[model samples]
Target: MAEQTLKEKTAKGLFWGSINGGIQQILNVVFGIFLARLLSPGDYGLIGMLGIFMGVATVLQDSGFSTALINRKGIKHEDYNSVFWFSFSVGLICYVILFFCAPLIADFFGHPELTNLSRVLFLWFLIGSTSIAHSAMMTKKLMVKERTKIEVSAMIASGIVGVVLAYKGYAYWGIAIQTVTNAFVGAVLRWYYVKWRPTFTFALRPLKEMCSFGVKILFTSIFAQINANIFAVLLGRFYKEDQVGYYTQGNKWMNMGYTFIWGMIGNVSLPVLSEVALDVKRQRQVFRKMLRFVSFISFPAMFGLALVAPELIVIGVSDKWLPCVPVMQLLCIWGAVTPINNLYIHVLLSQGKSNIYLYNTIALGVVQLLVVVSMLSLGIYYMVLAFVVVNVLWIFIWHYFVNKYVEISILDVAKDILSFCLISLIVLCITYFVTKLIFNIYMLFIAKVLLATFLYTFVMYLSGSVTFKESFTFLLKRK
Candidate 1:
């Protein structure tokens, strides 16, 4: 009966999560098109230059306590209060430090405009920090529906604000304002939807208790951010802002593709895995099921994005953004498998093995930095290609650690995803040849999307893909 309940809860979470991701992506595409058309790559590049700083600051402000709270079996009001105050304080401090460091950042990038641009952009951390506890509460309760409402509302409000400003010639400032507005709106909505309110009372013990687990997560997140933004940092220093802009645009689209899958997997994976954490057998079962679901969705989505990069970018954002195409395609390769890596990490976290997660991520960040630095002279395309190759291959390393706790071997991991991966590749290859005769880019785009969707669906249905069948059934029932 408990297993049945979990199954239902998982389904409901996936449904809402998918809606959240889908709506958010659509809004992103809509707003992204307008802003991309209005703004230049250098405009995005200016903001992209601040990516690492903002990412690290945001990570520091949250301090991994949200995940810690979710992972805890029991929680008290004081715990949430303590986290709220702690996060609020940390956000203030990080912002202040970055505010003063802005000029140095600008100097490093040889863009004096970044001094002011970064100071304004840095405000998102402050606005976002206040909602950490509230957001964590929603995640813990699996309130994806509420979270979805909050996210979509925030995106729409911010998108309108961003588009208007961009249309008014605000340049990168439009993007920056949009970002800060999203945080502000989401924070406000989180407070509104989450009933829990923090009291003035705060305690050190709870913070200390969670910190032992959270501190590892903290460092792990830090390294993870560094790895993600290393390219931006390197490109900013060694190349032009427009070059960094191109990579940023590419990485952004790649992120949107994978984030759609990761958002759904993330909303349920940890909380559900934690529920079954004490039962090795049950945890393994849940983990594999989620793995299959992620594989079924991720492979085709990312591979298809890569296949249609040229048409999508040209039609959606115009040829001025064309330089980002190769970069996007290369990054899509890594994006295809990133959610699987995330699922493996969640398994480790659910089992209270954050130290392993930390070490592995630290190693990954180090290796990625070295790899990117080595390939710097070869230009952006090769650098991104090498980066993608390194990340995709790092799945084995993640598997090595996860196996120690979950006993999910590399072979088991490969078995779950390899078929989906191969099928997606073959289908896309066939679609490419099948649609080669079409000359109009718009028709070509439509044909590729339709033909690929039809082929992949027919294949999955014919092969009796349990994941596909279950997902389709669930949607039909929901409808």
Candidate 2:
């Protein structure tokens, strides 16, 4: 097989990554709409409550070794072998500990049902640990086409199972089973594609060497997971299950939106950037282009989500989910900028600056947690508002490190993305005003999305946006 040029590989990766992300989210929206209507808010809350435990356990199981493998130079079979065994062991340990502590977890949330649910739901991590090495190998090699196909297949299979179980009145169990199924299928596919088998060799030397880099990533991932799931914990403990449900629903939609843009960036950026990690000039060029492309999609997609939140919630899942509208709106703003933070983090990671990533994540996580907790008296709205503020501003912190390491200035990033951000917001505002008077929810949602998209594209075309033009040209060239 011939080695692909970097540009060809990146273009192909982005193409498939976009398809994978776009279709996956569409499936999520379909499955989510059905499940949200079929199940109650309390059902989502039950699952959401277990998020923190599952999230933290997932971090421990991976033990940061997949990332260690990605960033390591001349990675050997021993590295993959050591990580697979280590992750498998950690998975077993974490599950056992969580299984025993399920009662305590239920007790903490004051929900007896969670005792059983926690044990069942935590199995995804165990299933997932078996695939870390395989997944990392594909990621390291930039096998986006294979990865994308596996993801789409898993999503369809899991979506059908989830919807069937939910429709059959299994409630949260349906959701839990869907998650496990996705993990199980994805792991199987990864193993089938990678064809890399672990030997009977168990060596502490490779594990120890990787751990030196992996430990910081492990800490960072733990804190990052905690930061993400803290709301579930707080709401589950301090508020009603329904409140947690509302937040979960809103967050789920917001994640789908951001993950769409990130899908293209995440799969390609790290591996591609790692190839040129030592070439500051080339890396900066690639990084800026990625920033512009992400900004082009993110700002409009997220802000447009905020615009149609009310209509999307009411029409998509019925009025039962209306309460999540405001929460979703607030989160959309936060989601808009998240990919930028993610891109910079990968740049740092590709350069082996894991310590910087760790420090920034911890500081941001602690401060955000403190702020959100402090605003508890003001309710979920204020908590979400505070979250948006901190997350949007934290880009500066991420950029500070990027500038230090890669010499990509804050001004450089802003210059690349700010125009798209401003233009997207302008388009959204115009679409909102134009569609505000529409009385029908269905028409209003469709019109707002269509008009905003058309206007954003038309404006970008008129302005001859380089990224916009490059995208179309690339698509045509690909055909």
Candidate 3:
């Protein structure tokens, strides 16, 4: 196979990434509707409470080797082999420990059933451990099409298992099994796609070399997970399962919207940026273009999701889930800004500034944890609101580091992204008012979505958005 030029690689990557994210979100929405209807709030809450532990364990299992492998200038079978063995070993150890610790976790939550649930749910980490090297290899080679197939198929298979089990009254157990199945399927498919096979060559030298870069990433990933899942932990501890469930439902929906946009950007940005790490001019150009694309989709999709949350929730999962609507609305704002921070960190990583990524994530995570903890007495709503505010303010913080590293100033970023943000907000507000007179929730939701989409697209077209025009042209050309 001839080596693909950077332009060709990037275009192909973005194309597959868009398809992957779009299809994944659609599948998730369909499966989610059925599962949410079949299960109770307490069921989702049970699984949600263990999110932090599961997240941290996942980070530890991979131990940042995947990013380390990607950032490495040269590749060898030994490098991949060492990572595979190391991760598998680490995952096995973590699972054994967590398996025994499940009792303590259950005791803390006052839910005896969690002892078994935790043991079963933690299998995802073990399953995922096997795929780290394969995934890294695929990502480094820009094999987005294969990866997209693995992920989408895994989601579909797992969704079927979840819906069936939930319908059979398995509750949280169904959710756990579904997750495990997805990881298992992805791992299997990754191994099949990437022909690299590990030998009996267990070498410490490759492991040590990668650990220098990987360790910082490991801790950074851990802190990031902790920051993200701290709410589930806090809510589980201080509030009822139902309360945690409400927040879980909302966060799930909000994540779907932003992840769609981020998914497309994230799949291509890191590897592409890494390829141009040495050229400041090229990096800046590439980064800004990505920034604009992400902002253009992010602001409208998330803000519009917030607008339609009430209707969407009621129509999809029934009125019982209405309490989650406000929480979902607030989280949609956080979701909107996540990609900006994510892109900045990816840029830093490509520049081999893992220390910067580690420090910034730790500082922010600690602060957010303290703030959320302090507000526990107030309410979950206040805590979530504080989370959103901190996240929005942190964009400047992210931009500061990005500017220092790449000479892309805050003003440059704002100029590129702010127009989309303001326009999307205006369009959503108008759509909301226009649809407020509608009596049916389904009609109101559909109207708001259509109106917002048309208005945003028309405005971008009128305002001469190169990103919008280029994206349209790119898809048309691909078709």
Candidate 4:
């Protein structure tokens, strides 16, 4: 009965998580199209230059307490209260420091205009901090439905703000304000939906108790953020803003593609896996199931995006953004495997292996930084190629540590995802060839999308893919 209850919760979480990710991405693409059409790559590159700073600040503000809170058994109001105050305090500190250091950041990137941009952008750190505990509470309770409402409402409100600003010729400021607005609105809605309030009885004891676990997560997240944005930092330092913009634009689409898959897995993976942490066999079973599900969605989605990159970019944003096409295609390769890596990390975190998580992530980050730096003189494409290759290969390293806790070998891992990966590759290749002769970009884009979807579905059905069938049936039942 307990297992059945967990299964139900997991299913519901996935359902709402899907809704959240799907709607969020749709809004992202819609608003993104308008902004991309209105703004230049240099505009986006300027904002992208600060990606590392914002990413690191946000990680430091949250301090991983949200994950720690969720993983802790029998969590209390005091735990949530402690995290809330701590997060807000850290956020304020981060914002103030960044505000003062904005000039230094601008100087580092050789962009004098970044001083004001960084200051305004840093506000999101403070605004987003106020909601960490509330957001964590929703995740802990598997209130994905409520969380979905908050996120979608926030996106819609912010999207409008961003589009209007861009349409009025605000340039990069539009993107910056859009980001800050999303955080502000989401924070407000989180508090509204999550009735849990932090008490005045903030205590050091609870913070200290969760610190060991949370700190490791904090460092891990910090390293991961750095790795993710290192490219932007390097490109900004060594190349033109427009070059950085191209990479940024491409990466944005790639991120959206995989985020749709990982977002759903993320909402349920940790909490659900934490539930079965003590049962190694059961944990492995659950982990493998999620692995299959992510693979089923991630491969075709990302690869298909790669297949239609030329047409999609041209049709969606126009020829001015065409430079990002190859970049987007390369990044899609890494995007496809990212969710599987995330699942492996969750398994380690679920079993209280924060140390392992920290060390592994730090190692990956260091190697990625070194690889990108080594390929620096070669150009952005080489840098991106190296980045993608290293990340995709790092799965084995993750699997190595995950095996310690879950007893699932690399072969077991491959068995779950490899076929899906190969099938997606073959199907997309065929779709590309079939659609290659179409001269009209619009027609080619539509043809590639439709044909790929049909072929992938037909193959999944023919091959008796349980993940495919289960997902289809689940959506049908929900509808």
* Per-model TM against the reference: 0.99, 0.98, 0.98, 0.99
Candidate 4 TM-score over all chains jointly: 0.99
How accurate locally, in lDDT, is each candidate? 0.93, 0.91, 0.90, 0.92
Q: How many clashing residue pairs are found in candidate 3?
A: 0
**Candidate 4 residue-wise lDDT at 70:** 92
Sort all candidates by lDDT, best to worst: 1, 4, 2, 3
Residue pairs whose backbone atoms clash in candidate 1: none
lDDT of 1 by residue, 280-373 (tens): 9889889999999999999999999999999999999999999999999999889888999998899999999999999999999888888889
Summarize candidate 4's per-residue lDDT along 123-225 as a digit string, tens digits: 9889999999998888888999998899899999999999999999999999999999999999999989888888787888888999999999999999999
1-479, model 2: which lDDT tens digit per residue?
21248878888889888988999899999999999999999999999999988999999988788988888889899989999999999999999999999999888889999998888899999999999999999989999889988999999999999999999999999999999999999999998999999988899998888887899999999999999998999999999999999999999999999888899879889888898898888889889988998999899999999998998898889998999999999999999999999999999998899999999999999999999999999999999999889999999888888898789777888799999999998999999888989998889989998999899999999999999998999899978
> Model 2 misses residue 17 by how many Å?
0.6
* Model 1 lDDT at residue 440: 100
What is the per-residue lDDT of model 3 for residues 297-363, given as tens digits with 9 covering 90 to 100?
8999899899989889988999899999999999999999999889999999999988888999998
C-alpha RMSD of each candidate structure in angstroms: 0.8, 1.5, 1.5, 0.9
Query: Number of clashing residue pairs in every model?
Result: 0, 0, 0, 0
**Candidate 4: residue 462 lDDT (0-100):** 98
